[model samples]
Target: MAILRRQFAAALAVTGLGVGLAGCAVSQDRAGSTPVGVADSLYWNGPILTMNDAQPQVEAVAVRAGRIVAAGTRADVARWQGSTTQVVDLQGRTLIPGFVDPHSHLGGVGLQAIAANLLPPPDGPNTGIAQLQETLRRYINTSPDVRELQVAFGFGYDDSQLSERRHPTRDELDAVSTTLPIVAIHQSGHFAALNSKALERAGITAQTPDPQGGVIRRRAGSREPDGVLEENAYFGALQHLMPRLTVEQSVGWLEKSQALYLQFGYTTVQDGRADPGGVDTAIAAAKMGKLKVDVVSYPDILTMGEGRFMQGPYYSRNYQQHFRIGGVKLTLDGSPQGKTAWLTQPYLQPPAGQPASYAGYGVMSNAQATAQIEKAFANNWQILVHANGDAAIDQMIQGVQAARARYDSAGTLQDRRPVLIHGQTLRRDQVDKIKALGIFPSLFPMHTYYWGDWHRSSVLGDPRAQNISPTGWVLAQGMRFTTHHDAPVVLPSSIRVLDATVNRTTRSGQVLGPEHRVSPWIALQAMTLWPAWQHFEAEHKGSIEVGKLADLVVLSGNPLTVPHAQLIDLKVLQTIKEGVVVYQAP
Candidate 1:
């Protein structure tokens, strides 16, 4: 892998070319010197939200060699325009910095695209258990990939959204296919429902004990397997059932995934928890020039550890062919909507067959979590931990506190920028500690739209549900945090993210937490500027500023001026990465 990385770098140096639109040239440097060429593109006559506090708005912007050379009034930007420049008239649309994904799985998004979409309303057609089964059957019969893989796989089925108000059982999936091993993943990505064949193939029997930090759910009052696997159990079974994809297949998924992001106006995306195969796929795709947007992958620290790949040339802030390994990801708990997040307080309504005291469970022991965190600190690697519940958040906070105490004198702890991903159940007290520890909060406020009603009634209950994703609390502490879609949990729709962050409205039309609502401007900053800083790329990629990469998005409506309720109606007209139009809405 080291040799391969070195060769990739050498090839990039030899090519002396930039990853830009055809017939255009861009410098690889973030803030490169002026090229001899005239402006490649000149954009004006639109609302430009710079996201740069120094210059919150601009009238015109000029792009030369993929960097913003001029951004100000029309006269100032027109200075760089030439006969060859492509003058773009925005025609009253809104132009803003391209969306940056703070925490999401790029590869998983691709997988979600190819898998049978078992999601509910507004995303997929899986309205009930019967619909989910029928969808899988259709995929098995029609998708060549499924036929080739010989396993019927589906994703994004939320029991809470289904008409039946429950997960499809082993027998239910058997109706789809008894011979083929079928796997249906929960929308949370924390659980899986496998058919009987899949269980048999995975060697999961009625006698199989639940794995540590995971659960193999049983039939009502019986030891018989019920086809549901939670947390580690689901992860392990998935590893066994999922077939390895060919390089071509992996590249195809990468292409499709980025296209999805482009349509959503995201130019800088993330592969939040990449495995070895995922890293390899990304590298191969980069070498093939398959990546259009900036892809920053954070390999799983617990499994991948500080291997040679972690120490490779790709592990830097700079992009190598539009891809780089930003840091490492640590998942301390499961999803809150799945009722699997490790919470301090007992769940208001636990999963079936569980005690009233159930508050889910942690993925690892406190000692284990601290050791992993300390190791990252010792290695000077920025860590992003997925902690949704307050108990999990507590574990992360205590772990960081311990590591900081040990590494502070050595200077390894300074400006490390540790991130807390998906702080859905984060307590107000924990917010202060996070701010004090300098741990960046990359929150998931979109939950207010997708699962707020479920949370209010079943998961966290009333006041606690209202506090999920708590953006207002972070602001009260004078801290900045980023918001995310956690794509595949839902589509990577930046508009939906903005709407949920700004409105905090539930599916039932009630405001889940009016106190936690933020202005659209603040939401935009969280998506663009704050997330870029979280990934340590704020110097060049986040806002629209001179000497920064010309990464911008065009929207049909100005988010700042649009009626608050109509925010979700805003459409992505175009997505530009480094001055190149990657996606223009049809």
Candidate 2:
């Protein structure tokens, strides 16, 4: 790759910015004389953590029109400052390249914006039926839009703690909202609890059998279906009822989500799932120049009909300026927490009386997955498949291998780099397979922190539990890796992800799978350079190099030196996109 050094400086000079700090101190010349070119903005006086290997640290940087002009000593950058250039004195803060989240549901974040203030039931083990009922009651009674269906989300209930040791039944939700439809999505997004009204509105009844790739939980001792919906079944019912919200309605939410990401130091995000309408919305926002963050949208292949979505990176002429449609996304399996992750082994303890069904199976047949991937590869499309269980990961790898054999026969598959998103339960053998096939794993190691305790106690049990989110194993296997929060599934916070990867701490403060923890620098790369490489944008983004995009986040403290547990609390003091300050902390 050809690295252009100081191209931005030349461009800035052409734009009439002078080539020295003296020009910055002087006023514009009169008589219609155009001034010389220089820097548009300068940032100095900080520990600049450039991800670039050549120049890992710098005292200052110069930017001109959204790209880095120069990155070197303060004096070197000062030469690029012109009359109108904006200067930011970092006051010795720590600055790093803006974070890039490899996998997230951006549209879901937009949806959260619509009802952000509406508190959902408490999450995790402490969430009881009584507490949930009270929270829902309060939302129903006090929210201004009570007449509308009360749709509360983000609820987590430990199967071990519930009185029934099962999801809240439709009857329980019916007790709260018979007149209105209520859908409470599980925290994992694998299951949901819908009221009877919602069930009826979706036309689901006791007679309806589980769909091919999903399940409908039925009440015990009765033929009636309960409110709990699993896997694609929940998605099917909800997809039908989800409002066809207009693009205008989505803007507010999108902006809210963007702000949250910026506050957490993210500049670019790969939206893992996007509907056609959602893509159009993002594109429209970009076209209108309203988008503050760079978003790479991948259409949801499952919802868009398999084999139909665009296969590889499809960029706009101004992709770096705003938005781009990068690839197609697929879900190979369901959530492990919900006991639907398509594992080879059965759950050690299946719910009482329910026959030990293997923790479900792949959403797509192996042959079908292979066919889909082959077609996508032929079309030069990058593919990202969500595979959370060992079985699912194996199946996905087999499909990818088949695709490589067929479409990559000449050893020139192009750098499509099909990704195994959320390779959370990867097996040792599969790591070599992934490396051989040139596939990347965008691991969700944050699971180790968010659900580590539950994973230890209930989900994976002892033997398999320790293997969750094996970051150290991935690196040792010589495979490139990226990590993400899958935001809206979890908030899009790189600090949280960094902490989880570096510390491997559970919610209860116990360090789980200590061997899996990686160093802070490696974890940072997973969130930044690795993701950029996965998206094929490393040439222009990711690191803080001379020619890279001037996207950065100024932090209150150096993340590398902060206490591991306090990493999550690291405040993003300012977020700069293309050298323009987009967010500033109060």
Candidate 3:
């Protein structure tokens, strides 16, 4: 690997090809001093997984001016070769279209980059409450920024995987800090635990009533908040406790987040839920020429309803400096792993302080949700709804149906491509409705690996658990669904997304839903082709074909031919965006 890196680097240096980000100098002109029919780069000598159904694999692909100029046999494409062209020898590796994110928060993933990691095994070291506390303490002690902020925030802690199998108490967090405020967000991001001082900082008290669609988990048999907040309660507290970042810090975090995505071979990513402020920050980053890969942001519809940002140049399908406001986002419910996702059926074991008949509740009433959807449709804005549980999915369906009925007289509302994110508990009956209504389902099947056991034993139990995400039913209906990592909930690891989508393997080595598992080829399409269509970018971004943007990823192994159990072992060796090498493995 070291020798390969040195050789690649030496070759680039000799060819005068500077390896940097999107802003780096590269020859893009086809009519200037450069030859008209010449290629800038050529990739060949290994497997090429083109997501396009026609000519799925090719012997060679040629790129020039950030577009694929030719893709065919080596003998056929060699005509485009020129003296200055930089040839990339695959050396038995695999090349595929760059991944297009279906759902995730790049801004939240940026925040995750700066905060202490509290995720459990395979991602982080927080396997128990003690380890979590220790991790926070270490972060606070080591991070100068956290000390300056005077509030220590940690992300991705899952109570289900902890030794105690419960959220850390205020007292437990207090053990780490009493003077400095502390906030620990649940792995699902729907829940959070705050120390007493942090709770005070957020102004939560015993007298405070639970907010609508949210819960303040209290002490046993008492009204006193136990530091745990769910849904709206957590969202509110988080807003109050979040530290403000300077422009430089915000842009730096965005770059760091993009770097993480690039490392995992994502050339196009989604900021699935963005606020006005986040959109502004992304614009600033783009203006500074800092973005290497394309970023599509879906601002929260509840906050910005057909706002001025939608009227800007950044709102178009074509990226302005690699950033655009693709659409609006609406979140209907919370996370299933946290037991707060609105569900039609009662939870098998309710969280503490909830009744046995407790099924999670939606963030808004059906009328309110429908009105928002109507507003989105009225403006012809594409909308993405975050719905996890079946009940939430029901409300989403109702909202879409109402909106389409009112505004789709020409039968063209389907062209808007409304998306349903994280349909983890989608019912078999709802599959046909989703297909009929043109709801693009962007599911997080990675939940199978991250929280499959918890859902089986605590959240839903038995048969209900086996059908989570329900990829098979969508396939059965001859429909395509996109899969996502929902980053910050999980790292934006593309290989893990592929592995979980294809295997449905849990942390305990159990195949959670054998029936829902897909072939590696199908999984590739979900991450690449289907998601590109989801983002309205299929024409230029999905597959490796002539005239498409040269957005591609080089992998250590071929996904289709790799042993089923060894998918996780595959690595992203290099990420190329628009014929330029943006990220190469070190």
Candidate 4:
């Protein structure tokens, strides 16, 4: 490897491609480049998308020691060709920048891997309470060491998609396993339905007081726990029984999630929120050299309280040791599909006990939110605020304004790269406010494909549903924004994300937000360059440049050239992070 680096450096010098390191100088163009006898890897691809505008396309790229040394036509990069160079001919495949998933939950990903697949159609076939019960039983019977676990756990149950059109009750889960505790979380991850055993083991009962921003659904006509928990209450109950979403719990599962993300061409994954245990696990992994793809976590301010979490070596501009706490996360509202998003307008269909005009509630008061944002800003921490509804977005904008007032000494908001997560029901004016506030909306366009029909007929009511992510509007402002799968809300598939973004097609094949659909090129930017910019790592990882790390993805088909309907058909042939191939298709 050492000798290979020296040769790669020498070739880079001769090619006038040296960015920082020094060596030899030969020709400025590929025609006159020298053929050195060394290179770690040489990919003579048909189309290498160097996101760099100056060189939008390249025929080949060469890497040494995880950094791009040269990128040009096959002949130019061939100059760097050496006896040891591992040459690869990307046969008509499209190679672009590796995806940077700016907003996702690594812990959630791990959990999804470890738990049972109780998700409804698309991710799983269980769409009814009976199927959910059967799935739980199957998971328990199949778990390798189920007896050793504290309890049986299943995840990804969606009330909206279930044939019953509602969440399962405690008694229903009890039928699966009455002797052992059982808990299945909703697809939203903000709610859960526990069996009677689980509720008893978790000490959740009719007498348990609801946490400030949560609810415990009660049995009718009496104060008895119904096993349904919402928001903080659900998470709180889960903390005791399921354990916090820590890396410790994710032992083998973390790697599974990494491989899954890599399969989707994600070279960089974000853990959007982490508790104290997750923080420890990440730090330990970083110290032990266990992280593969870069995992950027934003410890939840609400979860670990303030400053008590994965207290970083503060922060790093790079993915140090494969892990780092890039920022702080705050959840101001719940999921939109779950009907818990704090919307200004009521849901088209309210919950059982709520009035027809029932909009969801906020987790914190305006003052509390402002203070948290101000505190994070004062400490110079990047902020990621989850706001799914228009009301939630409004709250975030106000909080950001307040934080700016308190921290902006020059009377201008610094480029802190604060991210407004979800932005599902944001209005046009709220978007303008987000831009003016200098916030990046890491919106979830996946909703279009996963719940567009649901949103139209149930949640947002027609027109509002059509504009869930509003990608086109963000593009209209000539400002860059990022999009995400928001897994484990939806499964993490960048192709699906790209497809939903470019198509906005619903399950019923209706175009949800035709006006909000963005072009494939713009959608790709959101997944790559825009997300890298959002995470403050654009200088190093966003694009394929001479100095940038050779983080690339080879797709089975070119997303840009593919027909709009066939975008999701694109597959990940390979994923390379820092010049190292982390995953490859079989």
Using Cα atoms with residue i matched to residue i, what is each candidate's TM-score against the true structure? 0.93, 0.89, 0.94, 0.92
- Candidate 2 accuracy as lDDT: 0.74
Q: For model 3, how does the per-residue alpha-carbon lDDT over 548-574 read when each residue is reduced to its tens digit?
A: 999999888998888999999999988
**lDDT score, residue 50, model 3?**
92
Candidate 3 lDDT score at position 421: 97
Q: After superposition, which runs of candidate 1 have C-alpha atoms over 4 Å from their true positions?
A: 1-37, 410-413
lDDT of 4 by residue, 1-586 (tens): 4443454344444432122111213322222245653567777535777767777788878898898888886666777775556666565778899999978888777777878899888789798999998888888988863565758878898888888889999999988988888888898889999999989888987789988879899988878988999998888887788643345545556677777899898989998878777767767777777777898889888777658553547366666688878889999989889888999999999988889999998898998998889888988889999999888888899999988887887766688889999899989888788888888888898998888888988898977997898988888887788889988877889999999989989988999878988888788888998899898888888788887888898888887788999997898877888888778676
- 1-586, model 1: which lDDT tens digit per residue? 3432342233234321233222222222211223334787766667999999899999978898899998897656655655555656566788999999997899898888889999998888878898887888889989998878888889999999998878889989888889999999999999999999999989999899999889999998888988999999998898889888899988998888889999999999999889888999999999999999999999999668446668888999899999999889999999888999999999999988889999999999999999999988988889999999999999999999999998887545498899999999989999999998999998998999999999999999989999999999999999999999998789999999999999999888999889999999999999999999999899998899999999999899999998999998999988889988889776
The alpha-carbon deviation from the true structure for residue 538 of candidate 1, after best TM-score superposition, in angstroms, is 0.7
lDDT values, one for every candidate:
0.87, 0.74, 0.88, 0.81
Residue pairs with backbone atoms closer than 3 Å in model 1 (clashes)? none
Runs in model 3 with CA error above 4 Å? 1-36, 410-413
Give the C-alpha lDDT of model 1: 0.87
Candidate 2 lDDT, 1-586, residue by residue in tens? 0111233233234332233222222222111223234777776656888877677789888889889988897656766766566655565688899998899988877665443222222223234666556656666776643444345433344444455556777888778778777776666777888888888878899898888778888888866887888888998897766765556666655777888888888999777769876776787777677788889988876666643335323443238347888878878889887778878877766655557765666787898888778867887878898899889898888888788877776867567889998887888888888888888888888887777777778777775777787777888987768888887777677778888888888778888777788877788888888899988889888988878898888887777787777887777877888877787776
Candidate 1 vs candidate 4: the lDDT winner is 1
Model 3: number of clashes? 0
Superposed Cα deviation of residue 27, candidate 4 (Å):
23
**Best lDDT among the predictions, by candidate number:** 3
